[model samples]
Target chain A: MLLFFLRVINYKKNNYYYNKIEGTIIFLSNFAPMIEDKNTPKTSLSELGEFGLIEHLTKNFEINQKSTVRGIGDDAAVLDFRDEKCIVTTDLLVEGVHFDLAYMPLKHLGYKAVMVNLSDVYAMNATASQITISIAVSNRFPLEAIEELYEGIYAAAKLYNIDVVGGDTTSSTKGLLISVTAIGHANEHVIVYRDGAKENDLLVVSGDLGAAYLGLQVLNRENEVFKVNPNAQPDLGPYSYLVERQLKPEARKDIKELLAELEVLPTSMIDISDGLSSEVMHLCTQSNVGVNLYEEKIPIDPVVISTCEEFNLNSTTVALNGGEDYELLFTIKQEDFPKIKANPNLTVIGHMLDKKSGMALVTRANERIQLKAQGWNPIKE
Target chain B: MLLFFLRVINYKKNNYYYNKIEGTIIFLSNFAPMIEDKNTPKTSLSELGEFGLIEHLTKNFEINQKSTVRGIGDDAAVLDFRDEKCIVTTDLLVEGVHFDLAYMPLKHLGYKAVMVNLSDVYAMNATASQITISIAVSNRFPLEAIEELYEGIYAAAKLYNIDVVGGDTTSSTKGLLISVTAIGHANEHVIVYRDGAKENDLLVVSGDLGAAYLGLQVLNRENEVFKVNPNAQPDLGPYSYLVERQLKPEARKDIKELLAELEVLPTSMIDISDGLSSEVMHLCTQSNVGVNLYEEKIPIDPVVISTCEEFNLNSTTVALNGGEDYELLFTIKQEDFPKIKANPNLTVIGHMLDKKSGMALVTRANERIQLKAQGWNPIKE
Candidate 1:
């Protein structure tokens, strides 16, 4: 079991899979599967209770945000941010709608939940300091299961150096639901909104897009195959990057740092959670500027391209409409281009045009077409 | 129909019932049944879309918090609190777990949700300034139904002088889930924690107790009756105060103000949420002290007492263990008692003792008994 666990780490540092039948964390290996026996005990949540469960999970986390005066144990967390304005954003994710537990690991679910909120904070060029996670889970889950969830939450919180403040934990009537509120601070001079883009401002995106969406497709396919044949092993070696992007996608915490180091401030910014096209449209609509996005310049990872081909889907379309990338899309002044020109992660996809240009995308074939926001609406799905 | 709507207000200011079958909000009238006709139009959520639905719901909310710089319509809300420390708290409410839609009004649910968070902030002797609401609803809800929900949210926000900042609206996999995050500000000197209580400190409570819990009992009983007969009209006339306490319970926002006016700062404070007994235990455990609460002094509303008798429950027991009162419970210096002695809403119920003394209650009959926290655990319920 130890050797198999080490082998699983060789696949991904955080790739531990949950064995539903045995109700334990394990890893798949070529030699033998790592599964705890069914006789292993599962601690009921009622045994620890709500407050005890919260304390048990959050005890390992230390408050490090300078603004965070108190966390976790108080009726309300306290903070003092006198130097900058505080930015707050919240997101709610419901099971079956925002995620499918069948393919999504609990730890990855926790990490992704935090990333969703932090990405919004970074979009405003703010340094995220604190987050409160509110979860409603049914009795179907054990205390150990919630521990797995919070382990992921702590992993993300530590990675981003944000404090885990106070939140409420309640029983849900049905499936799991997660709500996260991210608090950040930003100086008035450095703050950015979606309405600041000017005509001719260069549109730039950090990192490649669409891999997370394709990764979801791969997981869904594997899930279907597993449902059909429980004994079949999923060989996810080739789609590691894509799968990681989907599972443990990182927020653009470094992008703000890089921009500061390079002395470049974005005129307008938004994160690419609802895909590039929707985010671009939001910037355009808010900033009163149109955009000319070249199809060839839209960043696409090699894995995403190959997977798109394998799935018989258009890679460019996938990049345009595939959601949950958690990448930053911002418009910077043309004069600032020189500072970011050599950066491997930064890609200039387009330039903002006058509003009368009507939000068009100039294709590589020299044809112009209007852009539409095909945002991920799980309600419809 | 218009006359019935007007009558609903005469019955109670926000007396509106949800028709589960039609998935619409209708005013309840004692004279006539509120069943919707089959010909009534039901607007699909797809018609307004997500963005349109949000805009329609939040357009009426105005930013009133001086600290709030930007609200709604942005990636994140911005707040500036330069002079004081910031306080943050969050709560999650799930349908069937926290409330039953059969009896609870959406607007009341919204108002109660905000009260839950604001109560926490006030417990720290902080002034709440801003709130963010995130909700996940199923397709069964129509645009108008959500409007009623937001109507209640805005009503609470307006009454409390809190700014409605940023929030997320999404589709739920099952029932409705609402999450609220409240932010407040306080001077470091004024801020109090649960661990600040000391031996001989006077323990005081604001307003009356047991009414909210009794109100829930009234609602639940009426719901059972209504379930058996859809046309049954719950007179609810005599139990108005109890019902209101459960539906639109006010947070003790004025407790901080009252304390300041009386020139008596609490050494330790906590909100009475999960029953007075549980909250008292929390304070004692955190402060490493014991408490002697006098049952004779425990504030119980006459209506609650009468209702407890009607339901065959002990009024004193309800006062100790009934939750959702949203009242302020705190410890103040014994010398400061003279300042609040004349205040009708304030009751000096007990005094703190050394940790070795343990927690005890002195009954009206002069009998001393140990106190136990029978907190409401909806998970078990």
Candidate 2:
């Protein structure tokens, strides 16, 4: 049943090249994406390290909220409550399920833990002011290791300028688990939820996509190469932007501010942590509308294009279904579009459609195609 | 190292009983004292099932705040910000490390999760009003399992009249993890911290102690029996109260209200989740004062006595070191103690001493022994 859904989405790409040895049969078909090639091997979490991964993951996130005092750059995220409107959101990250410590560092794990929660608060169009982090670890983690996790937490808190007010810490017999509850405040009118889009609204994205997905590919390929030859060092040349997107992605706090400065309010909004298609589908479904996205208008970073071509993958498909972008995907009225178009960072991707039209992608050739979401379905994999 | 601490606490007792007809060997220990054994053993969480477990776990939790217009028994906890002071607290629970799920039910787990945090807020002489829960789980669990966990959560919310404002959910590679953050409110003047105790302050406790720990021991014994012989039914005759204390515990919300009604303010306070000794020590250490606990004055339920006799454990030691009673341990001025003592439910077990004298336990024989914390240490076995 899970496979049927995957096939229906048609987002899965089977064959891909590893950027490593220019030419080498590293491995064959499996659900996992290729991260590296033959010459460049994968590195352990301890080697590539925490900061490196964070830098790799969050480079392209566009800030969307003026109230987001701090985004992924801090310890606890900082948010300026508008009119004392309380910000509320929840996040759940499973071990082995969401992360593989074999390739991820504990400190980064802790850092990412805070980032994910902050992302949700930002999605609500509210500045993340305070967060309560909860973690359950198995006996495998030592006291010192737990302390290391907290160090990252404290660091993030310091960076974000949010209080580490309270959280629950318990033991689990199985694996490590973390859950964070983030709270922020905003004006009752300024806060955006998922249910406000209307027909003819312009769809806008804060930043480019597919870089994080590609980064994961690079890491996986490198991992395969290292398994074949442990002595080989990873040569992650020229793909730093893509690589960073996967390890430490950021939440867009700036674009949110820009929109406010322009006096433009999003009709509806959600962060693209899953995939563009999935997030767009969410906006449409929640708002009881449809959408038409122009393929030509979708922004693709040059690095993503080059990498896609090198790997024999369609850059469009990568942008459409690739996950972990953490960019803001929002819609605004037509009148607001002109005001935002002047901003170099904002991209008008498409427009909301009437419910009867359903959701579709309009190619540069003017050919219309149905837009289906192939989200990051970890369970299916 | 862990064993050294356990031995020092000296609460350990082992008993071997041979049931001729059943041809079974049973090992028992006495740890908690407040609960009725028979009532507790019959309704193990497993027997009641997950949803049943939650209902059973939160049956006794009381709400004391007007702002907490709602609590543990809801889809999302609700709160009314009716000009009341707000206070918040959170705690985390880990598997294997913090609890042996072997004897702990999912419902009880949920109940305990909320109680622990609520207890913290109660310690501050605050009324708990809202809570946010976060959970991380491994794929080893089915969606139904997660629902079961939430069932327990909802049960607690409803029971306590706390609104479930927000939380996070994610997957874990290893074990099940739950983190609960509770928000409470109280008049500014009424809020109590651990450092408020003064010399000659009377130490008082709400309700009896030690049953939860003893309840854990009974469950462990039954589990051992079932593990050895899958076909054998658990022989939990006449130990219900103790088992319930271990499985489904309640927070002391009532005491907060009662204190307010009597017009008595506690000088210092903390909840007894980490055993009376540890809490007492905390009050002394934080307040820079000494304490002398009269052992004979400590309250013990009748069931605790019979269980202690049956298990060959000293009831006093069990009451001292057993944890998770969810009762409030607090200090009041000498004048206020008379007001509190007039209430039958309150027990004045000890009084604050000078800092130079340190913490001590006054035995019935009039001998004073230095007190040390030998409570449940999750880090140690």
Winner by lDDT: 1
lDDT of 2 by residue, B236-296 (tens): 5466667666656777777888899999999988888878998899889879999999999
Fnat for each model = 0.75, 0.32
Model 1, A3-107: lDDT tens digits are 111112323222222111112222222221112446645677777777877778788989898899989888999999987899999998888888876666677
The positional error of residue B332 in candidate 2, measured at the CA in angstroms, is 1.6
Per-prediction DockQ scores? 0.67, 0.21
Over B253-348, each residue of candidate 1 has an lDDT whose tens digit, in order, gives 878988898999999999999899999999999999998999999988788988998999999888888899999999999999899988887999
In the order shown, the chain A TM-scores of the predictions are 0.91, 0.77
Task: List candidate 1 segments past 4 Å from native.
Answer: A1-36, B1-41
Looking at candidate 2, what is the lDDT of residue B130? 72
True-vs-predicted CA distance for residue B28, candidate 2, Å: 19
Model 1: TM-score for chain B: 0.90
Error of 2 at B338 (Å): 3.2
lDDT of 2 at A329: 87
Docking class of 1: medium
